[model samples]
Target chain A: MNTPTPAHVDGNAAAGVLREVFAVDLTAAVGQCDNCGCAVVLAEARLYTRAPGMVGRCPGCQAILFRVVRGPDRTWLDLRGLRCIEVSLPDS
Target chain B: MGIVSPGFSGRRRTADLPPGQYLTDDFPVLSAGPTPRVRPEEWSFTITTETGREHRWTWREFRALPTERPTVDLHCVTRWSKLGTHWEGVSLDTLLAGVETTADHALAHSYGGYTTNMPLADLRDGKAWIAFRFDGEALAPEHGGPARLLVPHLYLWKSAKWVRGITLLTHDRPGFWESAGYHDYGDPWREQRYWGD
Candidate 1:
C-alpha cells in the first residue's frame, strides 16, 4: 500500500475529524481564504497532518484556512482564518 | 460507514493517555509538504526578530551549543499519542541566552516553506529545544533532521520540522497553521485545540 505524503493531502482528508465536531460531513463546505482572498471548497484546501493537529491551507495562496485540533476532553475547530465557511445542509 | 483496517485495532485505552488520544507504539510521519533534504555542511540556523536583528549559526556552530536529552510524550491532533520519546538537542534557553528581544512570539520557518508560531515564552526556560538527534542517532530528514524545534508543552505541530530560522515578533502573528484554523496557543493537556474552544 502506498502511504500518502503528509503534506500533499486535501480537505477531504479532514472529513473524519470534522464530522466528530460538526455532525455532518464538512468536506463539501465552501470557504474563502482570509489571507489571499481565494475561494474554494473545503475539500480542496491543502492539508497537513504531520503536526499535533490537522491544518488546511488555501490551495491558491497557501494560506492556512482552517485547523482542527482534537484533545481528550474536547475538540477545537478554528475557522476564523477563513473569511467565510458555507455549508449546504441537506433538504429536510 | 467507516472502513476499518485489518491491523489497526491494536490500540487500547491507557491511564496515561490524554483525553481523546489513543496509545500508539508507532511514530507516525505527518507533514504539510515534501520532506526536506539538507546537508549538515550547508545548513544553518538563523534567529531574527521584527526589528531586523538576526543571529546566524551554521550546523557546526549550532551543535556547539549546550545540548540535552529529554523524554516526553507526543500528542498528535489526529488522536494518536506516543509517550517516552527521547530526543537530544540544544535548549532554546541556551540559544536565546545572550540574544535580547522584547518579542512576545516566534515564527519558526523551515526549509520547505513551512512555518508555525508560538509565544516566545513557550520556547524558553527549558520549554523547547532544537532537536538534532532522536533515539540516540542523527535525526532523519523524513522526521525533520539536521534539527527541528521541539515544543513538548504544546501539540507536536508547534514543533516545526526542518526548522531553519526563528522570527521573533513583538506581537503574536499567525504562522502557517494559526492563520489557517488551528488554535493560536495549542496546549493539548488543556484541550486548547481550536479557536473559540
Candidate 2:
C-alpha cells in the first residue's frame, strides 16, 4: 500500500533531535495551546521541519506550542505558547 | 561504496538558486496541524494595529479587491527550492492602501491558529500577498485555501498558510517559530535558519 504525502507529522518525528536537549521523552508529555486552550499530548501536535528547526503546532488549532533549535554550541527552546507542560517522572 | 540511483545526477544549477539549497519540482506540504476546512462564505480577512483599530473584509469583499499574478521562486529553510512557482493574490500594499500606521511589525494569524511575525516593511511594495490561487487553480485546502500569506523573500514558514489576519505592532514581538528557537528573521539568502546561524 502507498502512503499519502504528509504535509506534516507529529512531534514524535522530532524525538531524535529533541533527545539532545531533553533527558526525558518530550513527545509523551502533555502540552496546552495558548490560542484555543486545547490540552493534548506533544505527540499529537503537528511537526514541521521544512525550516531550520523543529516546530510543534497544536493539533486542535495549529498554534505553535514549542520550538527547538540546535546551534553549534547550544540548544535553544521556546515554549511560550504552552500554558503548561506535564511530564511524567521516571521510576527511581 | 554507496549506491547511486539509475538517473543520479549532481545538484542542478541555476542563477536564482540560493546557497545550500537543492531544486525540486514537488511542492511539499508542511503544516503544523490538520488542514482547516474553511467555507467560502464564512471566511474573512482582518488587519488590526497596535492601537486596537481593525479593518475587516469578507471572502467576497476580499476577492473584489485587485490582485496580482506573480511567478516567483520559493525557498524552504530545510533546503528545498521550488523555482518558477505561480501565484495569484491581492498584494498587501493594496490591502494596506490609505491605511495609516506607525507600526514596525505585523503578526500573521491563520484560520487554524497558526501565526508568524514579520516586519511591516516585508509586506509592502509588492513584497507579499494573501494568495488564493496557485498554478492557475484555487489553492487546495491542504495548501491553505481561502488564502495564505505569500512572503517569497523569506523562508516558507514566514509564509503562514490559511492566513486570516494581520496584527500590526509598534514593537517587535516574535511569533510562533520566532519565539521558538528559529531565527526571528528567516532570510534564505543569508542562511539564517536557526537561532544563530
Candidate 3:
C-alpha cells in the first residue's frame, strides 16, 4: 500500500514552518465495523504527510479506528485509528 | 512518565514526543495549522507574574478589558513562522499594574506546564497580552480559545495555548514544547524549533 506525502508550502516566516502541508482528498469507502460487525459506508480516508491522516471512525463505536487505503486490486485496511499506542488504561 | 512540570530541570525532548503529535486541518488554514470549528464557550484565562501571584479571568472580563494591538512574529514548533501578527488584548504592562512583581522575580506561565522567564525590563516594555482574538477575529480553540498568553518577542509556543492562568514565580518554568524536546526559546531567525542543534 502506498501513501502520498503532503507537499510543503513555501511562504514568509509569518506563514509558519513544518512547511509540509498535506493535500487531502476525501475518498469514501465501505467498512465492516470490528465491534458490531455492522457495514458502514461513506467512510472517509485522508493521506497525510506523516501517515494516513484519518480513516474510518465508528459512528457506533467511537473506540474503533482504522487506516484504509487501496492496495493493488483490493482495499487495504490497517484497522487502527491513532498512531499512538503507548497510552494505556489503568488495569483493574 | 514523571510528575510533569514546566521548566523542570532535566526536561524531556520532542525527539521523545510520543507519537501522533502532528497538526490538524480543521479550519480553513486560517493563517496556518488546523483549528477546531466548534467554538468552546466555557473556558478560563489566567494571569501569572514572577511574584508567585495567580489570577483567573472569565470571558466577560477578558473581553471587557481594554483592547490593544501587539505586532508579533509567531514561530511554530512545526517550523512555520508568521510575522507582524497584530493581536488585540490587554498589554502585559497594563496587566502588571493589576499585580506587583519585583524586577528580580518574573515568569510567564502557560497550559501544559509551560513557563518562560521574563526580565522586569521586558515586562515593562508593554508588548505582551492574554490574547483572545487573532486576525481581527475571535480566537479559535485550536489557536488557543478563550484566552492565551502571547509573548511576541520569543517563539509562538511561548504564547501558550489553552491558557488557563498565569503564575508569577521567582524562577522560570519551561513550557510543554520546551520540556518535550522543543527549543525552550523558539526563535524563527535562529531556526530553533526542536531540541539539539
Candidate 4:
C-alpha cells in the first residue's frame, strides 16, 4: 500500500513491553513531559516501534517521553524524557 | 549447540537464526512516523563530508549507476530475522569512490526526519547498498522506496529507511534510536538491543 507517510500508534500499543517492567498497566499512568511540561496519560502519547525498542513521545512537543527495550533476560526502561509519572493505585 | 531431544519437534531449525531472533517469512513494515511518498523524480541521494564537500545523484543518475542484486539475510534488533531477501541497488563503495572523507563514522539522514549512525567502514567494501528494488519489484514506500540504505550485517534499523543522504562525521554520533537508549552499534548476534547491552 502507498501510504503517504508513516504513522504511529498510541502508547496503548506499548503495554505488552511496559508490562514486563511495571506491575500495573502503565498506559493509564499520567506522565508529564520534561521538555514541554505537557501532562497526559501514557496511552495518549505517541508510540513509535520502528526501532529496536518502543518509544513513547509526548503528544505536545514530540519529545521522547519514555523508551522500553526488551532483551532475552532483562528489560531496559528509560523515562528521562518525562518529569514525572503519576500512577493511580487502588485503595487497599 | 546441544543435541535434539527425542520427540521434540521445534517450530523451525534454530541453526540459521541469530541469538535471540526468530525467523519471519513475511517482511514486516515498521516506521517511526508517516511514510514519506517521495517520487522518483524528486528523489536524490547525497553524501556530505565533514569538510563540506557534497556529492549528489538525482534519481535518474542514481538509476544509471551500476547496480548489483544481493541476496542477504536481515537481522533486526527487534528479534526478527528474514533470510534470503533479494535486493537491487548501488553499493556504497561505488558511491563513495571519488568522495573524500577523513571521517570514521557516518550519520544517515532520511526524508522523514529519521536518522541512524554507523561506522564508515561498515558502508564500504561491499558491505552496504542503497537498495531501490526488492524481490525483483520496485521497493514499496512502506519498505523505504524510492531507495533505502541496506546494511544487512547489522541490525535492520541501521539500514535507515527513507534514507536520503549521509553526513560523514569525524566522531560517532548517536541517531534517533541510539539517543533513546538503544545500543549505538546494534548487533543482533551480540544481543545489543539496549544501551548497556
Compute DockQ for each candidate against the true complex.
0.23, 0.29, 0.02, 0.32
Q: Candidate 4, residue B45: CA error in Å? A: 1.7
lDDT of 3 by residue, B1-197 (tens): 78867557553334422232332222222211223233335665665555445666666766677878776655444444454466777776766677765545345544433355544454457757877778788877767665677876655556655566656656555543344345555555565555552
Superposed Cα RMSD, model 3: 18.9
Sort all candidates by lDDT, best to worst. 4, 2, 1, 3
Q: How would you encode candidate 2's per-residue C-alpha lDDT over A55-87 as one tens digit per residue?
A: 788888777788877666778888888998877
Candidate 1 residues lying further than 4 Å off, grouped into runs, are A1-92, B1-13
Clashing pairs in 1: A7-B32, A50-B30, A50-B31, A52-B77, A52-B157, A64-B180, A66-B181, A67-B181, A72-B19, A72-B20
**lDDT digits (tens) for residues B76-124 of candidate 1:** 7667888888999999999898788899989999997888899999998
Indicate the residue-level lDDT of B150 in model 4. 99
**Could you give me the TM-score of model 1 versus the true structure?**
0.68
Q: Which candidate is the best by lDDT?
A: 4
| Each prediction's TM-score versus the true structure | 0.68, 0.77, 0.49, 0.76
Q: Where does model 4 exceed 4 Å of error? A: A1-40, A58-65, A72-92, B1-13
Best by DockQ: 4
Candidate 2 backbone collisions, by pair: A7-B29
> How does candidate 2 fare on TM-score?
0.77
Chain A TM-score, candidate 1?
Answer: 0.70
